[model samples]
Target: MIKKALKTAFPYSIPILTGFLFLGISYGIYMRALGFSAAYPIFMSMLIFAGSMEFVTASMLLGGFNPIGAALLTLMVNARHIFYGITMVSKYKNVGKKKWYLIFGMCDESFSINCSVEVPEGVDKGWFYFWVTLLNQSYWVLGATCGALLGSLVTFDSKGLEFVMTALFVVIFLDNWLKEKNYFSSLLGLGISLVCLVVFGAEKFLVPAMCMIFIVLSLARPHPEKEVA
Candidate 1:
């Protein structure tokens, strides 16, 4: 079991390192610029626990975005986590006490790990899930800490730095798409979101797009039989 777990973890080690390092560093930079200290990132990652939200919070902090607005927006952005939990509830039943952690750690990358790996029979499913989650969250926290430090050094060219978060989303979207599940709905989401973006502009479009997607996708009942998709 240990050997197989190690073998499985091997393939993900590179991506897990690379993605988290750069992205975490970038977020750290932004957080520092927003007047957040080292403790901020640690607490945020530990408690707040949203990768994209952590980045957006930097902007929100700078802009004086209140808790209510932040919470609502966060719900909109990470609404997907709910779906991830719903799908995993059954697979995670045998997880026992670890089920809480499973729900808590259901971030984008964590979900990818949970959904992607096929556990060996008789191996501990809970431990596999826990380790994958722990590793990814470690990357995120490390990245954010590194990013905060790097932000102190590089002060310019942050204009396009925001795109890092978007790129991360694109990668996730592609990963989900390549699995041949939700590819169509994702395309529709892109189309509708783009149209909404052009129509309402960036700030105003997000809520509306989220609303539309929720209503449309829910009404469509996309691939109801296939839980993972």
Candidate 2:
């Protein structure tokens, strides 16, 4: 069952494998450029596991400690997972003890593949989901570790590598845009984020953007008729 699950999950994870490896490596190099040791990347990649948040955390660490602000910032950055969890409640119901790890490791790519793919006949759904999540994270951790180790040995220009996160998000946005028919949610999010960024500036825009997003989404709940049709 596990072998079959791995085989099936591996194919679905290929795209993530490529993307995560590159982004993860870039993150590690970014941290190394900031004078952090490899331990930082390994632990953060394994534990925090939120790619964009991890990048933001690096900057926060440099800005001095503020547990309250950090906690709120982390929550705001990862607020999307609340919606992901709601959508996944039924799909994750019978997964047994694996549910804990699945929820822990349910980053964007893992959630996307696991939520969308139908497990093949005779392959256990729990195991398939577990493998997908596990493999995606493994790629990230491995890539980060490798980049950290390589960072000291090579010292070329890596100034613009920070944009890796932006490039990754753009790819994800395009993927979702191509797959879904409804643009309301996407457009609203983009518009609101842009406006907030302009008004609040980069340092303070996230909290307000999240607040606005939540308020708007709550008030704009789709009708049952449209959902069913």
Candidate 3:
């Protein structure tokens, strides 16, 4: 069952594998440049799993200790997962013992694929989701470990590596947009985000944008009674 599920899950994960490896390696190198040990990235990749937040965390760690501030920042940066969890509750509810890890390992890539891709007939959905999450995390861990170990030995310009995460997200968004028929949500999000960016500036726009998007999407969803009528 695991083997079969792994086979089914791997192809969906290939794009993520490529992106995570490059970004994860870049993260490790960044940590090393910050005077951190390889163990830092390895553990952070395993524990945090949120790419953007992990990068933010590197800077947080460099600064003075402030648990309350770090906690608030982490929540703000990862607030989107609240929406992801809501969307996934039904799909993941029946996954039995694997549900815990599924929730823990639900990174952006895993969520994108699992939320969108339909599982094939005869494949165990639980195992399929599990394999996808595990594989993605493994790629991140492997890349971070490699980068941290090799960071000291390598010598070259490391500028612009931070943009890898943004690039990966753009690819994911475009892929989903192409597959989707209804452009309302995409356009709405983009429009709201742009408005928020202009109004609030990049430093303060995220939370307000997320709140508005959630409210708009919730109100926009069609009612079952209306559909029945």
Candidate 4:
């Protein structure tokens, strides 16, 4: 079952594999440049699993150690997962115990493929989702470990590489926008987030933006259905 799932799921994950490995490596190198050990990235990639938040946490670790502040920041950065969970709850209902890991490993890319793709007749949907999650994480961990270890030996400057994550997200948003004709939700999210960021400042904008998104989306939910009909 594992082998079959792996074979079936791998092709779907290649783009993520490429992107995650590059971003993961860049993340590790950033930490190393900050005087952290390779184990830091490895453990973080394995445990935290949120790419953007992990990068933000690295900077946070260097500054201060306020547990309350950290907790709030984590929630703000990962608030979108609330929406992802709502969308995925029904899809994940019958996956048995694997649902826990599926939820744990539910990064954006993994969620995209699992939620949208239909499994082949012979493939186990649960195992296919599991492999997608597992393989994506493995790429991240591997890349992070390698980059951290290689950082010390490399000679080039890697200053400003954190933009890679931002660029990656832009690419993802654009991809989804291009794939679907109805982009009201995407446009709404982008417009609201940008306006909030401008008004509230980057550090303080995420929570407000998320709140606004939830409220607006909730109100507009029925409109989209009506438009489709």
Candidate 5:
């Protein structure tokens, strides 16, 4: 099982590793710029393990976002996972105790790649997915730690580095949208997020956007007439 999971997880190390290296450096840069030491992200990544959230964490910590506000923002930004997790219910049938870790670690990128791939009938899909999650996280930790170490020395404008993370999401969103037969649902997400962001700002917008997304997705099912045609 270990061997199989390692093999399956190897291919994923490339993308995951790339993200960790770049995003880790970005986080380190942001943290240092905010008057924090390099060890901050290293510790945070181990505990938090959420990339985008970690970026927000640096600012939140410095500005005193508070636990309640931080928790709310975390829930809002990551609310899409509730839907992502539903798809895994049946897929992880034989996983048992491992299900807990799986659910806990499931990220947007990990879920997308795992669900899209077909793990042969005899292979342990659970194990394969598990390693992918593990490796992805390892990359993040490595990137953050390494970046923080480097950030202490390298002195350049980190102002634009933060945008790299946002750019990554844009790329992922576009790639996913391109694969969808009808991206109308995705468009709805974009529109809803924008509106909520404008009205509620970052801290308060996540929950509203997430609720709106769920409502839209639930009601936006294809019409019976369209389905028949």
Candidate 6:
């Protein structure tokens, strides 16, 4: 069962493998450039596992030691995961102990694939979810370790490497947009986020945007009676 799950999950994670390697390596290199040892990136990749937050954390570490600031920033940056978690509650409910790891490892890529991809006949859903999450994190950890180890040996321009993550997000959004039959949710989210961005400005928009999106989505969800009719 585990073998079948791993085999089934690997292909789905290929895109994430490529993206995480480049981005993760870039993160490691960034940490190295910031004078952090390899252990920093390796452990951060293993534990934090949040690409964006990990990058932010490096900056925070260099700036000063403020646990309050770090905690708040982490919540703001990852507030969207709240929605991801809510959406996943039903799917992850009956997965047994694997549910805990599934929640912990529910990075954007893992959530995206697991949320959307259907399990094939005879494959264990729980194991498939577990393998996907494990594989994705493994790729990230390997990439971070590699880049950190190589950081001293190789020197080149990494000026624009940060944009790789943004590019990956764009690709993921487009892929989902194309696959979705209902554009209302997508349009609403994009519109609300844009409005919030303009109103709150780049530095302070995310949390407000997420809050509004949640409120609006909850109201927009059709009632059971409406769906039945």
The candidate that achieves the highest lDDT relative to the unseen native structure: 3
Distance from true position, residue 29, model 6, in Å? 1.1
For candidate 5, what is the TM-score? 0.74
TM-score of each: 0.71, 0.77, 0.88, 0.80, 0.74, 0.88
Candidate 2 per-residue lDDT over residues 1-229, each given as its tens digit: 8899999999888777777877788889999889888899889999999999999999999998799999998888888788789879999999999999999999988887787777889999999999999999999998898788885675556566555455656766778788888898889889999999999998778778878988999889888688865
Please list the residue runs of candidate 3 whose C-alpha ends up more than 4 Å from where it truly belongs after superposition.
Answer: 155-181, 227-229
Candidate 2 backbone collisions, by pair: none
Q: Which lDDT value does model 4 have at 192?
A: 97
Tens-digit per-residue lDDT, 1-229, candidate 4: 8789889999988877777877888889999889888889989999999988999899999997899999988988898788789988888878789889999999977887787677898988889999999998898898898889885675555566545455656766777788888989999989999999999998788789889998998887776656766
Query: Backbone collision count in every prediction?
Result: 5, 0, 0, 0, 0, 0
Off by over 4 Å in 1: 1-7, 63-65, 120-122, 150-229
Candidate numbers, best lDDT first, in rank order: 3, 6, 2, 4, 5, 1
Candidate 5: tens digits of C-alpha lDDT, residues 121-196: 6667878888877887777888777777786676555455545445656766788787899888879989999999
Candidate 3 versus truth, CA RMSD in Å, comes to 2.6
lDDT of each: 0.73, 0.86, 0.89, 0.85, 0.76, 0.88
**Candidate 3 backbone collisions, by pair:** none
Q: Give each prediction's root-mean-square deviation over alpha carbons.
A: 4.7, 3.7, 2.6, 3.7, 4.2, 2.5
- Candidate 2, residue 194: the lDDT equals 100
| Collision pairs in model 6 | none
